[model samples]
Target chain A: MFVRLSAALLAMAVLATAGSANAQSLTGSGKLLLTGGVSQIEGAAGGGLTPWAVIGGYGSARQIGANVYATDVNTTDFDIRSTGVLIGLYDRVELSYSRQAFNTQDVGTALGLGQNYTINQDTLGIKVKVLGDAVLDQDRWWPQVSVGAQFKKNDKAALVTALGARRGKDTDYYISATKLYLARGILLNGTLRSTRANQYGILGFGGMDDKRHTQFEGSAAWLINRKLAIGAEVRTKPDNLAIAKEGAAFDVFAAYAASKNISLTIAYADLGHVVTRRQTGLYASLQVGF
Target chain B: MTFIALALLLAAAPVPGQPGAATTPVIATDGKLFAEFGGREGLVKIVDDMFVNVDADPRINTFFEPAKREQTKARLVEQFCVVLGGGCTYTGKDMKAAHKNLGIQKADFNALVENLQKAMDKNGVPFSAQNKLLAALAPQHRDVVEKPAY
Candidate 1:
């Protein structure tokens, strides 16, 4: 499955041609490198775990940009994989969709669901840039802010229902703000989210209480150069299920922007209690955009 | 919740006014580097380097051809000095009036920005100081980018 996924992801990356990149400046004028951020797991432009306020792609205000990404996270107890496509319109709006596969490697057998049972989810996201410029306004106190939404649907709805989740589908709303200090080569992003997912919607959303909770996610990165950035991210999760206590997630990561169109991110993530305890892992993602 | 608040606070920490990568200075902190940048010497050097690239820039070279190189350099130094908070005051034409009829498109503006970055890097200007100047100059894009994105 990993091999197949790898092939598909590579094909997506290769499919984006340089000819299709319209502008002479693939990224906007005055925008620093890696300012687009990396593609998040849910297909938003951001850190590995949390979405940032920057719009996805290298498009300036008058141009259009698109992105495609694939991710694989191998942990001690599970293997989580995802692939997605995203498009940024005029550097103001972003639309994204991602498919996630959560493979309960040994845990599936322990739960009597055979070996390597996989839970599939599809997420659709929309974000609109509503505020200041993260890059150009660095001299002032302004931060770029955006409002977004992600609607997620579980493939195996019946199985998720049996696992004590109230629903197999739900929507999450978020508002994120991002600021940059180019002089210091630092970037900061903070997001407020409203969600009720159980283990990131692998087991589904809104467990016993069936209540929505507000959460916070944030990321900070130090830009090493035009092509490299190192950072850390933290994402809060809702605990609504009686079966297991959901814990917050965090990761330490680095991203390399190989070019205007390609980026690779790697992180060490601690997604506490994904049905099991302390699911620490190496998270890797490849993104291609223009 | 406290963690989130803490993280936001950390991120919002005020950016310090440091000179550049050149000094790692403790209280060589007299804002000397910025003052130097504002001085006639540093401003002249920066404009000299910038115009050299402008003459070679394919996208915007023709725009500079009609103007006298030395006059342009002198005016730029004055403008930069004023922007950098130097004691000197600019006597040049207003930004929009000066840039008018130059056919400055976004591509042209972008090319000039790249050239400026190169010049800054070559001048040993600290990255932070360069940004401070750029931030002041960025608003001029509204006046300079006469055409749509190019």
Candidate 2:
């Protein structure tokens, strides 16, 4: 149960970050509000946070922005680090890419996957706003929506497959909705995602199904002021490798919008053990755009 | 529910130190403007003249083409009222952000501003008051325009 909860939490954190990164801008709908900032969440949809229904960071048609970011995830057996770039176009559409490097530790020798094997994964993604500005139309019935996709390729797929994986490459699709109640300074966001990757390959893939997995994700943010935002998310994912149980995990985060071009995000994550204990860590991201 | 009631009360409360009460400025200013424009009956006449000027402007017509002109005119009245210190909230984008992405050229902006000036003149807004409002909006040009606006 702990492992399952931790996995769920990890997924939730990623999604939350993606949403913040993308929707940080006030342009809730249309192609005129993209920004160049990293989200507080990592590995979700936008540069840092989970996908938001809005098109870009808080900027509307009046500005342009972009971001470059890096992240490191430390585990007992291995450490994973990633670096990426995000670009916003006309405050309407976004393009992003990241490369992740996983370094195996003593656990690699014990498991025989390889002695200190290095695994690299590259991901590319795009997000487009579909409807409504949550900020401008706070009293309306419409919710802001966006559609996005990510393509990921694992560089050490041969080794991963040989270790018992069904597929080496995968793609994910997501539809996200974001709404901001400006009067109350509250923002709500949700995402429905479909993916084929197994457990983010923490325990390796191929134990169960290789088919696409359908997931539900949601988050809420309270804008305390123009600069500070506090939020949380709960995300559902598949426990394919028999490592963790299937369920939802929670993520709490804080973000600071330093300016139109820069922002910073930080979070504390708890990833429960698949077999025995829970794993918790600190996460941080910085995004800058022009 | 209580919040709604409070909002309504606040909206209706009289403004202080004018032809009416002395506690609320919104009501007083609204009354002043209403009287200056010849009261509720004259408001209709002024709206008609304003619409005539808006209809003659091609640059702003794109935003008006899809709508019922009468309805648009009503919203504009509310907007103008709110902007001119009538105490009504104007639920619209800040001028800079709204026009920034439209790639609105200087000619278009000048034409629209001129048309609005004409409407205000037609509505009999004092020249000083019109110039004050235009001055307040002038700084917005930096954000609303991305290219040389000439």
lDDT of 1 by residue, B1-150 (tens): 433643564467444333211111121234564564645787788888988888887657888755477787788787776656554557777777778887675446656877887788788776667766765666566666554532
TM-score of model number 1: 0.79
Score residue B106 of candidate 1 by CA lDDT: 49
Each candidate's fnat, in order?
0.21, 0.00
Which structure among the candidates has the greatest TM-score?
1
Question: What TM-score would you give candidate 2 relative to the actual structure?
Answer: 0.57
Query: DockQ, per-model, please?
Result: 0.21, 0.03
User: What's the DockQ of model 1?
Assistant: 0.21
Distance (Å) between predicted and true CA of A237, model 1? 0.8
**10 residues in a row with least lDDT, candidate 2 chain A:** A28-37
